[model samples]
Target: MYTVMIVDDEPKLRLGLQTLIPWQELGYEIMGTAANGNEALRVDEEQIPDVILVDIRMPGMDGLQLLQEIRRRGWDTHAIVLSGYADFEYARQALQYGVEGYLLKPVNKEELSALLQKLHQQISADRLEKQVHQDAKSPEWAVYSLLSGSHDLANVSIDNLAKSLGMDWPKYQIVLISFPGLHPEEDERIRSFRERLVTAYAADGQSLVLYFAPYTVLLLANTLVGDFGRADLYRELQMLSGEIRTHMDVAAGETVLALDQITNSFRTARSLLERSFFYDKGRVLTLETPESYRQAPSSSKDTSLLDGEEVSFRLYYLVDVGHAEGIHSLLDEVAAQMAIIGKGETEIRERFFYLANETLRKVSPRLWSESIYPGEPAQFLAGIYSQRFIRDLVGYVTAVMERLARCADYTSRDNEMRRLLDFIERHYYENLRLEMLAGLFNYSSSYLGQLFKSHTGEYFNAYLDRVRIDKAKELLTQGLKVYEVAEKVGYSNVNYFHNKFKKLEGQSPSSYQKKS
Candidate 1:
């Protein structure tokens, strides 16, 4: 409800006006009354009112003076000027002060009611305009609009937007946020949540644009307008991260950009999002600082020394296919190359960022954009040659090398050995002796023993014993008794099983069970 203050020098007039009007029916509360301008100003300082009804002429510091003081203070209180004199000058001055209405002396109930209704309409319109402006500036709306691809529809070019909207060109910032491990349906849920949040911000007259994509969302806000404070933006983003964590049980990363720098922002956000494979997810990551991009060396580079396009292709392939070994090897080689160049960690990071950004630019121009090329083509080529993309290229090349290495390792294994291992894994419960496995896979027991040992780095009996013990351990953890575990692992002789378990595990099955 709106609040109104009445200022009149006559006590009876103030009392009559206070009681005569059905203030509650008119959506206002008569908060207080003052006999003079000084008292009114004091009341206003104590508790600002939505509207002030002031009498024009008074002994000292009359309504006009009080209105001037209120205006000077930057208070938005609507003024209704009441006067006994039939003076056009007083009315003009009140109008100049942006008073809501001018009421003649001995104000009639009908006239007062009509003026109050008009004030109510004016207040409603003002409120709605404020809300619209707020919604346009909200972060939630910014993110939602971006996700819905409405920014494109809005034809939101920095130049055209400023000119058409009559808004001062201000630096704009974009932040790309990503959540990994979200299933398709959960991603949809996130989009819906974003839409609701956008609506809420819009209702509050904040302008926030949101863009949603697979596994991520983009937030665009104007940094210049101070429409929404930066601290508030950070708080809201953190809140959003927390909300997603509650449902998806994962954290999200954020990358920010200045106005018209969305392409770079998206690149950083994607890079940070991909880091979820190595780091914890659902955390806000801002790329404005150097600390946010820190990452451990990729493991793929550690295992190989491949060079050129071969290295780049390999690293790309391994990361694309989720090959752990290849990824590690590529990272290791990249690290080693960076060290050889005498590059500090920060320099190494810059090299990696530039190389990855460039490679993505080549393969996925639609996504990475031409910003990767910072200078003339000739200069860029010169820099590439002098700095050597070959080392970083080797990281990618070796990623693929590790993948092929894994494949070759699998193929080079003897068929008899592979068959034996497969059988052991599938039927470790109903296992027979080595001779039985050799016969089953059509190999001599002695040859099979050597083959299994060579491929698996363990004797056939040792492998079988390890498998049984591991299974037994699992069963024991499930509350199985010692003998029950032995039976479950296909060991009829509990004594032999216990002895083998103790020999292999450094503890008897019963003791292992107890510890577990």
Candidate 2:
């Protein structure tokens, strides 16, 4: 089936386009939707839809401008314009620019289906013509064959392919450009970029460029044996990588080998690129980073033993009661302990997975499936997984919890209020304020204060002060000076700290310290 992309500024119109037609029956699949012309360009790169249905007007580069850009870039994708009015001028321009179809807004189902059917027929005929005219006699095609594992060097004439690119060398290297999050799109711009890189290298002598993956481009460069050390070649590749990054945001890695070592150099280079997933700071990779580094320092602490069931139960309860702060506290506590057990990707993921699964099983069972995991459950997991560092993971998990908390309908308000008291106990020393806590836990400050008094027999500020003062008392017992103890427990003003301590402990700072 031919893929179709929808581009319109109006979300309702985009939704209508998505659901209005019998797209599947018309031999079309909805590839993706974009809000405006600029977004359509990016989505086009990722989707490469067979046909694009775009509204005539949009903010920042209208549909006409976008179609012009597509044509300028020589993208083979087709365009269908959506016009709000029967403006002959716009229709004339669209036709002049080779738009396949133009339809009025609030599209009719039959007309939309007919246009798709016609496009599919045209695409089929064009496919036949393109196939008949296709040629594979290029060095890029040869390198693609190698990278794709389609033609092994033992069975293929590498020398001929190398000669095709005017290269005959005793040593070679493969440099890989990798885009981690980019959606894969087939476009001539990428092909042309590869060709440009080949031309740049060819100026000196020998290089072949090929599209390896949707997000990867490989450049194979040949050199005379002993002409340059591997280090020198790697340095050059690093410079090229920097140059490429200036033009496009991508991480790059490289592997150098003797001419005879092309057998697995490409694979090795690609594997080297995977290092970017763990070590994101430095983009260039000359050697494989050890697998052990994939994990943070291993810890003897076991996260699962940290009462997985109890924690999961609490998390589910908090989510159900809409206790946002409680959920955040629980996730933070769990994640902190998990990090102590070694920040290994698998260990962290598995530990969090246990917590997530246990909680999800109770909260949202359908989220566990791979088919729809990309929803909330999957997004939460993906958000956590994408984090390269444990610190980032903590922030991401907390953010997800906050979002889940916002969705709480608050059926059990009293239960949430009780959880808020517990939250204050855990976070009182961290500059915990009633306003912030109220927002975090999805309650108004006035209601939060009333609930605090109801649950804990004290106002929100009074309870927070007691919690801090109690913590300060412990530090005092440990022989810390009064002012030091006060700062350690979140009190900033010494005078206010003294007043609260005097009121709670019935003594001034000097008296409390002297007694301790």
Candidate 3:
């Protein structure tokens, strides 16, 4: 579907224009609205519309000025002018900019509808003509054939194809540009990529551009191999990628002289692009990268370093203990191990997907909040399957481990309090305070005091006093001296211990010992 943008300074007029026509019914979608020329330009920067409905008079920049700026930037966007007054000069300037329709303000619905219908037909015809007129003799068609390389090419040679396209260059290389992490709309961006490449290179020589699914192929003729011939194109592509805010990777094949090596050039470049996850992004990968990452000898390739299940088990254990540092460390080790595992990319991806699935499954309902961990098993598998590189996938797994670990950390509050209570029970003779335990266990003293009462049904100090006196009673009954039992029960002041014991046990230590 075609996209259109409405640019006008009047919010009321802009709102009126929108309701005045059924945009999608006429084969166009109103992608966005802008109040002024500068805002419209920003919108255009993000996504250039197929058509523009612009008000001729607006603050900051007029409709004619906007059109001129657009054309200056080489965007041949179709324009429909809206003017409150049909001044002769405005009409003349709009005509100069190739305005598709000039409509008076307070537009008639039928008039705007008719104009849009005509514009839609024109755009359709233009697209159809462009596709129909693609010459079979062009180098693009020949590149596609040669790059397709198979036994079916027995009847076809690069010499014959090159002569048809009149290319006598002794050196030819295939450079593949690919965008990873582009989701459902990637096909549209692929088309846009081809258009940009064709426009940027049409004048240099025959534009050798074709789309091979995710990769856009460009055959540079008589160009030096490696970074020498690619510096300019790489800069331009990097800029294009910046516009889309997507990471782009370029792989240039080694220089080849024969027509048949065209397929080899294609294969090498495609392989490099596919293996980009192993290497870094944003840099051009070339001959050496693909070879090194290609498969090692039998001894190396067959050696398995990453036992996927074992890694998952370790991750699960770390999550159970709420060990964020251990999780990150183990994931780093897993990345290193995967590198040495020497498995195929697809196999590695599959193995890691299982590992992630198994690890996430261990995050219990208490630790797994839906808000933080939204991915399901199938989604995790698909995400890992589609991730562009090893680094991004590693990051994804690390985040899962760390975030779930945090969830466990938060949920383990009650458990830490229980451990603290048990510590008090075993060390009643040692001096302790609610504040000291709170600081050691990373809690506030007041909060821990409340938690202690809530868990044990008594205040912290009161509970400690009761435990000491109860122990003193036992020791005194076993024939220990009053002062000795007092000191042993954590009360160094024998008189104070005697008073506390009398208060808790309803008598002095000697009286309790005789009763027992």
Candidate 4:
């Protein structure tokens, strides 16, 4: 309920105004009353009411002075001026003070009720606008949410989202944006700038949603009206980039897209973002068509090197020995062999893209996107374009491999850490406390704690909790009942399980199950 305050020198007038009006029906609570402006200001500071009714003519600080103080303090209270005098000059002064309405002395009940109704309508509209903005950041509402990772809405029904937005499926256009060389702070600034532009454009009936990621922002807008042409959109985007560059030195690129092909547009935008290394800085490159910007083939040979058992064995040998340089060299050799078989750089790139995607599909199917390459897929065959993004990926794979290798090492010194991890993973569903694991492994609990940390880089208890949580996630995803999942994950106490799940997953077990 919204709080309301009354300020009048006359006690009877204040009481009549308070008691005559059905404040509860009008969506307001009479929070406080004051006999002077100073008292009103004090209550306002303490209570911060949503609406304030003040007498215009008063001793010391008058209603107008109180209104000025409120404005100076940036308070959002809606003010209504009340006075015995209905002079035109008084009403004009109230208007100048940002008063929502003016009431003559002995205020009419009908007039007050009408004003309350109007305020209610305005508040409701504001709430609807906010809800709409939030919806735009979810898959059910905006395509931009997909590229920016703002929402894991891959499973959301698009038809439901369209219905909520009052948009036809074919009426939307997706614009994928990329910002290179942006730090977290710079990314925030750029995001704010883009939101402002979207707000301005939306004033003309264009609905827009902005989604931000580490290095990119995506915009999804309903452009079915065709009021704004493609060239106009491009010009506005260029202007926005120029404004951003004035504040921060960075390169921003965008790719406009039709609704049905948003996933492809996102890939095109990402590829363009990466290409900034090869181009001039602070350029707003737009991928109107990906086919037109295809690169020339690499000078690698064409040969089916992977088809030979000897080559396969040698490649695996290099990888097994932790020779990253050797693995890269072997890949280069394979690329060269393929070039010799009359395969252009484009052809080799296409083959490698297919191979890499297929490998990832098997191991991490959840991360795969339907639109792997944008524009014309054939154009992506020029070279393995995603090589630059593989550094972190390779490092991760190497770490996992190193951990597994340590588990397989012949030395007893390192075997304890591996054994602890293996034991935890295998027996997370049992009441396997730290002391139990320590005794089973023939080590003191304190010594085992230090060993686990030195090996896994995490505390023993934390590691165990992580293992249990991961197992719980797997069980929950398989449609286990909440209580059953709790028991299966070794948490016999349902309350404890729910609390732990919430603490780790940021949601309750039931909520996570519903979402999955």
Q: Top model by lDDT, which number?
A: 3
Candidate 1 per-residue lDDT over residues 203-280, each given as its tens digit = 443234344344434333443223234346546655655456632222222323333444455555567544432222
Better of 2 and 3 by lDDT: 3
Best-performing candidate as measured by TM-score: 3
Decreasing lDDT order of the candidates: 3, 2, 1, 4
> Between prediction 1 and prediction 2, which has the larger TM-score?
2
Task: Name model 2 segments beyond 4 Å from true.
Answer: 1-135, 151-164, 181-196, 199-202, 220-263, 271-276, 285-287, 290-391, 398-516
Provide the TM-score for each candidate, comma-separated.
Answer: 0.30, 0.39, 0.46, 0.29
Candidate 3 regions with alpha-carbon error over 4 angstroms: 1-134, 149-166, 179-189, 212-214, 222-232, 241-249, 290-305, 374-382, 410-516
Model 2 lDDT tens row, 383-421: 666665444555566665555554654445667666666
Per-residue lDDT tens digits for candidate 4, residues 1-516, read 578889888899889988998987766789999888888887636679888899988888888888888889988788888988869898897788788898786788999889976775565445434654677644334654444344445786656655565543444444445444443223456767666665665545445444444333434454422324544555566666654553222222333334435556556556655553332333343444322113323533323454444344333333222233444444445554653454544455554555443333332222222224232323432334543322222333333323323333234444656656665676678666677555445578999888888888999777777788888888999998989988988888999989888998899988898888
TM-score of 1: 0.30
Model 2: ten consecutive residues of lowest lDDT: 246-255
Error of 4 at 458 (Å): 99
Poorest lDDT segment (10 consecutive residues) of candidate 1: 247-256
Model 4 clash number: 15
CA deviation > 4 Å runs, candidate 1: 44-46, 139-516
